[model samples]
Target: MREIVIGGAQMGPIQKADTREEVVDRMIALLQQAKGAGCDLVVFPELCLTTFFPRWYMEDQAEVDQWFEREMPNAATAPLFAAAREAQIAISFGYAELTPEGRHFNTSILTDRDGNIVGKYRKTHLPGHSEFDHDRAFQHLEKRYFEPGDTGFQVWRNMDAIMGMCICNDRRWPETYRVMGLQGVELVMLGYNTPSVNSQDSVEGLEKRLYHSELSMTSAAYQNATWVVGVAKAGDEDGHPLMGGSMIVDPNGYVMARAETEGDELIVHACDMDACSFGKSTIFDFARHRRIEHYGLICSQTGVVLPD
Candidate 1:
């Protein structure tokens, strides 16, 4: 059995006033905990290093750039990498990336057991609007801050398994998983900082929001016959609340473990990568079941067209 013990490191909120140094300290603490728990890999939430900055609108380019990292393993995050290397554990986390060419993206990276980065994924399905809107209960200016990811869905061979990565809103889209599923991915990791309540609909509460998050991940895991690890940066960030339903799902879509609180928590599970074989060879065998010829419209059109 190709078994891997994975840790879902759910982080509490990072206030705007918090420094990267301080945030890295919190992550190192979690890494130490994961080590004690015998985890081979640890997954952290999207934008794990900072507060969910997209909630506020800022016109000053310099001010906006402060939240982005021009380089990974920079001065602020080097220690976390060092710790992971010393512990001999693989880790994955999300951060705001600022390219030398002056481009920005919501990105995540995956590392091998020796702490070498093996893969990177930029978030494709960016939610919220770019422009400031008076209608929104709060601004979610992700579009204003980041360009849609140019790196399409891709997978890598790591930890003796075919693995893939996505971030936040990308989890809600079936196409995200379908692309990786077609690539024969065995494990998928994603992170999120979703609000506890819907900004557009006041009636949608925290429970319903959490339900939708689980529904998306569970369905995707079963349909693709792959294991999924979803971690969250939860609890109140300043006054805005982000929901926490961090979990690990088996290939059959059963929740093996979950976090009970919206706090800094770690959920661990021993997953056998070979367990994916049954569904992939039988029910979800794309080679035997998928009919791509009839699905031209999926790539041909971006929006719905009415029947003539």
Candidate 2:
């Protein structure tokens, strides 16, 4: 059946005062729990290692850089990798990456069962503004802190299936899934730290925000005929709240499992990769269904064009 038991580890929050060492300890505990639950793979939320730093505006470059990791599996995160290797489980998580060339990105990495990093995805669709927006209820300076990801959506062959990744705001964009879907992806993993309330719309509450998150993932899963796992770093981070609707969806767009709380929770499900075949071969067969010639405008333009 090519079945894989996956675990979505939804973390509550990581306050600014939290250390990487402390965060890794929390992650290891989740990994241990996943192992006990017989999970072959575990997925953690975007910026899993620290508080969503983009929510704050920092003027000092050194202070900003402190939130970024110059290297993966560095001193602070080595133990988490070791624990995953010891448990023989695959894992995926997101963090702020600082390149040697002085570039920064919101990045995620995928590891194999033996704990070898096989794939890395930098978040392409960054949300929020770069400058201080007096209009916003709170700051979300992602554009100020990170460069838009250069790596296009790409898939890898792992766990005996074609897998792909995106992060946070990328999930809301259809192109993110379509690109990976075109490559015959069978599984997609993504993570987010979305606010419980929309910054721009004060009327939009937690329930509506969660609904949109699930709708995006579920619709994408069905359209692409792939299994999708979305994990969230939820609950109050300091005083700001992040919503939690972490879930695992089947190829048919069914919610196989979901987290019950906005805490450090693990939702597990046994998914058959082969289940993707029926839809892919039928309705979603790109080769048979897509008319690329009529879709040029998708790549040709960024904004809406009015009729002449």
Instruction: Tell me the TM-score of model 1.
Output: 0.99
Q: Which residue runs of candidate 2 sit more than 4 Å off their true CA positions?
A: none
lDDT of 2 by residue, 1-308 (tens): 99999999999989999999999999999999999999999999999999999999899999999999999989999999999999999999999999999999999999998889999999999999999999999999999999999889999999999999999999999999999999999999999999998899999998899999999999999999999999999999999999999999998899999999999999999989999999999999999999999999999999999999
Per-candidate TM equals: 0.99, 0.99
Clashes of each: 0, 0
User: Model 1 shows how many backbone clashes?
Assistant: 0
- What's the distance in Å from true for residue 212, model 1? 0.5
Q: Could you report the Cα RMSD, in angstroms, for every candidate shown?
A: 0.6, 0.6
